[model samples]
Target: MAARGGGGMTASTRLAYQYVVLRCVPRVDREEFLNVGVVVYCQSADYLEVAWEVDRDRLAALDPGLDLDQVCEALTFVEGVCAGDERGGAAGAKPPGQRFGFLKAPRSTVLQPGPVHGGVTTDPARQLDHLLSKLVT
Candidate 1:
């Protein structure tokens, strides 16, 4: 459901939204992690977006020996997965929902998606920005 807001803006419909945090673990054995990015998807709106912030200072705090290059590459991959672009490879050919599912799947890697969280939103794009701001950055 939606309502008209002030300024003649129509409130967005209550649509389902899913999101996950991207974590980077320098050493998986010790299990310490840093939230580097976020992925958001709204099936109803056919929207999938990825937003990330990789602060070298924070990464170094996690592991002084951490490879900044590798981390950036991993972040790029996440963005590609969300974009479903040619860079995404085979996964890019899939639909928006499938791309989201692939990104959210559990995997042991430098860049891993945390648990998926659900919520309601009027605008998926706006919601993506909101979640990325609150959760990732």
Candidate 2:
């Protein structure tokens, strides 16, 4: 028999999630970028979050003139959106799925998101950390 839990639901079942790698594009014209973070959205779990780390040495190598502060500020805004906080502006007020959609949309900016990818996991938070380590670090 299948295991059950609260509300008669499966106690430990895999959940579908979507994610994108956040990139620091120092030069939009040249399209050179470094993977800097990961954003994961799991509707089944009502989860949306981002994990990022700015590799100062790598970023400086990519573009010595790049503005690290501005990139970090942009990433903060993204975090706010994921948290549905005021700092994210209008996007943050949106629903979790909508916020994820906003984050995944393509844009020409210092911080850009890579293509969306999907996976299955029982825990999105752990998955985010895993992707951040594997893809960004």
Candidate 3:
């Protein structure tokens, strides 16, 4: 049988996903920030994950007094939320969609999420890594 969508690929192979870039705004007042990580969620694939890397030098350039440890801690909390483990606490207990919503919600904190963007991917994990490299790194 011919595959659907004339692409010779089953729907299962092309899963829709959404992602957001996580930024660290050392000083909310100045609104200066650096891309530190990315969060990817695919409901069809039941996948949710986050990857992050901190450029200590770049972050320090934004705010000399900014605490690097605090930034790492916040990023860890986000990773925990994506994992839906105990580290996320109450937010982690919710389903993937809810967790994504909570994470994408706007906040004034140092670590904030950018606008949500969507795309199709065959492998959510691979897509997450690609986004992490393209957008965060």
Candidate 4:
């Protein structure tokens, strides 16, 4: 269900990645609708990188064996989900009935260019710092 990442991969890679994450990852954030997937990660430099999200309930219901390539597959799925949200579609796409119960809906991904203007450092460690400064500026 999960596949590892070290090379180029596409959307089809998610199932493999999900399997790996389900096997190794013990705890994941479970407070929101976000809990449906697994959040597998590894340490890199400083910031916590979200490697992938596995379907939590489904994975628990069924066991997926270790397949080396599966890890990269799931990461692709997470990438898809992130890309989908960034289009400004998912937030406004919510059903009308669901909107009534929640006072405020979570913000969808809006990736405007930062005040470092067109330059976001290639370094992931600088992401938080760049974003924080942009927010205040």
Number of the top-ranking candidate, with lDDT as the measure: 2
Over 1-137, each residue of candidate 3 has an lDDT whose tens digit, in order, gives 10112123354698889999999999999989999999888887777888899999999999999999999988888877888888889999999899999999999999999999999988777788899899988
Candidates sorted by TM-score, descending order?
Answer: 2, 3, 1, 4
Per-candidate TM-scores read 0.88, 0.91, 0.90, 0.22
lDDT values, one for every candidate: 0.79, 0.87, 0.86, 0.28
Clashing pairs in 3: none
- Rank the candidate models, highest lDDT first: 2, 3, 1, 4
Where model 4 places Cα greater than 4 Å from the true spot, the runs are 1-23, 26-65, 85-125, 128-137
Task: Supply the global lDDT for candidate 4.
Answer: 0.28
Error of 2 at 33 (Å): 0.7
lDDT of 1 by residue, 50-114 (tens): 87888889889989999989998877776776777776788978998899989999988878889
> Which has the higher TM-score value, candidate number 1 or candidate number 3?
3
Of 3 and 4, the candidate ranking higher by lDDT: 3
Better of 1 and 2 by lDDT: 2
Q: Model 1 misses residue 126 by how many Å? A: 1.7
The 10-residue segment of model 2 with minimum total lDDT is: 1-10
Count backbone clashes in candidate 3.
Answer: 0
Give candidate 3's error at residue 72 in angstroms. Answer: 0.7
Which segments of candidate 3 are over 4 A away from where they belong?
1-12
